[model samples]
Target: MRLHEHQAKKVFKDFGISTPEGKVVNDPDDAEKIAEEINSPVVVKAQIQVGSRGKAGGIKFAEDPKDARKKAKEILGKKISGIKVKKVLVEEALNIEKEYYVGFTLDRGSGKPVAIISSRGGVDIEEVAEKTPESIAKEELDPIWPLHDFKARKLAFKGNIRKEAIQEVSRIAQTLYKIFTDKDATLAEINPLVLTEQNQLLAADAVLNIDNNALFKQPELAELREETEEDPLIRKAHEYGFDYVRLDGNVGVVGNGAGLVMTTLDLIDYFGGKPANFLDVGGGAGSATVENALDLVFQDPNVDVVLFNIFGGITKCDEVARGINEAIEGRELPVPLLVRLAGTNYKEGLKVLNDEKLRVVSDLEDAVKEVVKLAGE
Candidate 1:
């Protein structure tokens, strides 16, 4: 669950991290009013979840109230990275002396929360890593111990921050760590943490991605989720008790578990095919659940083929087969489907799907190759 810039800034404010004064407005008139109230050069930023808003022409500088309205009109209702910009964040622009990047996220390899600081800001961290790895500093926080001010200060020093700004940078780092842990966030970031002309630090931009599994405990954060930012199929999958993630590919993948689904996606790529989505029907999926999963996969127009890799343990293979046949009973499915059923009533399931039009391969590798071939056709 990714929070919009305004929502992330709200969370940052609660933790004593300063952000530029901004108001979220859906209307151009409201944006103009906010800019007039600020009475300074303001930035109109699209509120879409994806990045590169500036490159997409979703971000514009408004010299005054009238210009703000013009910029808002140009931004609103525009699509950035395929998401419609229904709202924009109008903020008082800052005069920055320098910019830095500060972020806290879980390091899966280390199995601990890691803090990353870089002198290079306003760009993707991955780019920094690829070009100038030494410009960034990283530290892993102990799970039992809180992120101490001293440790954050040390990290700032390591990042080669000037002595005058180290204290503010350290403070911001500590607050970011707090937000990451307290809110059950997978990522909390402030790109271009800027030093103003007055020598004050502020987060010019903010991003927070919460752990969906922890949303139950953080109702307030959960409420900040913008459903419009999500793919329709993903929302529909949630309603049907399945986990689905959309991807840019042509082959639709479905499996019984997360690990299996991930492996299937890799295999599709290895076979010179791209996966359209990751669909996990869970361990105990019934025929109805399988039908719903198939229906959801077919909803994606990019999907040229559907591949089912079911190593059923708790979910019987026959149930999955029945669901697939039932889903394609009357409707003419434009895309071909390939099924691989290896465990739990495999023979019975194979017998159930013995139709000549339906392609069934018992071997996983063979199934992937078949799907790749059919998708290409």
Candidate 2:
């Protein structure tokens, strides 16, 4: 789960990190009021989850309250990265003398949290890594041990942080690590941690992504989720208790396990077909669950064909077959369905599908080839 910038900065402030004071407003009038209250040049920033708001014209600077209202009006109804700008963060603008980047995220390769700092900030870190790798500093820390100030200072030095700002940068780095571990976050990033003309440090922007699995443990953080940031089909799938992800393909895939779903997608791609979505019904999926999954798949207008690949271990194949049949009963299916069932109650399941006059395949590869051909036609 990802928190919006204002939300992330609020969390950071709670943990002793300095950030520019801001107000989140949904109305242009409120934005103007907040800017007036600040009594300084303010920045109006769209609160969408995606990045590059500035490039998208979702970010604007206002010289005064009236200008703030104008800027907010321009951004309020616009869509950035397909998400509507329902809210904007209005904050005092800083006169940045220098900027740096600091972040902490899990390193899957080493199975530990890694801290990254860069002298060059205010841009995508991936670009920095690709264009100027030498300016970034990275450190992999032990999960059991706390990040020490000395280590953070060393990292700051390596990133070429100015000597005068090194201590403050190190302190922020340490605080960032604390937030990462304390919140069970997968990523905590502050881009353009800036030094003002007065040499004071502040976090100009904040981003935090909490581990989905850990949401149960952090109720408050979990409540900050914004459903608008998710694809509608994906959100619907979640409501039905299935795992789903949208993809850029025409074939819709439904399977019993994550691995099976992944393999189904790969097979579709290998055979000159594209998968429109990844839907995992999970273990022991019943008739209702399968029906729900199919409903979600058909909701995508891009789907040219639907494939159900079920290897029933705990989930009875007969139940899955019933679900498939139930979904097809009352509505006109816009696309064809290709099903491959194996494992528990496979005979009964096959009988159900056969009785319904649905196309059934025993071989996985044959199923893929047949679906691709049908989709093409």
Candidate 3:
């Protein structure tokens, strides 16, 4: 789950990380109030989950309380990267002498947490990685041991952080790692961890994404989901009790398992079609679950077609077909749907699909081809 900037900064501040004083406001008047309270040149930042809010005109500077209100009015209710900005974080603006990046994420290849430190910040880390690969310093830490200050300091030195800022950078990295482990976070980031004119290191931006699977153990962090999770599609998927991820594509996919769903997505891509969403109905799904899965896919305006692939084991294939039939029965489908069923009760499932006169493919590749052609992708 992605925490909003304000929430992430709250967590950071609670951990003794210095952050500019800020307050979240939904109304423009409240924004002005925050500015007045701060009594300084402030920045009005849209409280959306996505990054690059600056590029989307979601981050604006305000000279005073009135300017903060004006900026808030311009930002509130506007969509940034497709998320509606319901709130803005009014924060005291910083005179940054330097910007640095501190991040911790799992390096799947090594099966360990990796710390990424860099002097170049306030921009996409991917850009820095791709263009100036040498500038970014990475350390894959052992999960069993805490990151020592000396090790973190060496990392800062490797990232070319100036001697004056090295101590602060390393300290922040250690504290950030603690936050990463304490909250079961998959990502903990501080971009533009800035040095102010007063020579203080402050986290100018914060990003903390808790692992969805780890939410069960972290009750407090899980509670932030309702407040921080802004993606409507993801929220809807959770409501339906399905494992889903939205994608930028036209082909919606529903499958019985993770491996099956992934294979189905790969097939759609192989056929030059985009897969709109990754939805796993999981093992032993019933007709209602399958029905709801299709309903969820059809809700996406970007979806031009849906491909339902079921490789049933404990899940009955016939039940799956029945759900598909019921989903398309009364309402006119906004997009084409293709089903490919195999495994347990396969013949009965095929019979059910045939009775409904629905399009069914016996082969996965054929289904992918037909769906792609139908979607015109």
Cα lDDT of all candidates, in order? 0.89, 0.90, 0.90
Clash tally for model 1: 0
Runs in model 1 with CA error above 4 Å? 39-41, 49-64, 79-84, 93-99, 107-111, 126-139, 154-167, 195-200, 211-219, 222-230, 248-251, 267-275, 301-305, 334-336, 354-377
Candidate ordering by lDDT (highest first) = 2, 3, 1
CA lDDT of 41 in candidate 1? 98
From the highest TM-score down, the ranking of the candidates is 1, 3, 2
Per-residue lDDT of candidate 2, residues 204-291 (tens digit): 9999999889999999999989897655676688789887877767899999999899999999989999888889999999999988
Query: lDDT per residue, candidate 3, 317-354, as tens digits?
Result: 99998888888888887877778899999889988874
Poorest 10 consecutive residues of model 1 by lDDT?
A: 226-235
Alpha-carbon deviation at 312 in model 3, angstroms: 3.5
lDDT tens digits, residues 102-144, model 1? 9998988789999999888889898898899888899888978
Residue-pair clashes per prediction, in order, are 0, 0, 0
TM value for model 2:
0.69
Positional deviation of residue 193's Cα in model 3 after best superposition, in angstroms: 3.1
Error (Å) of candidate 3 at residue 114 is: 3.6
By TM-score, the best candidate is: 1
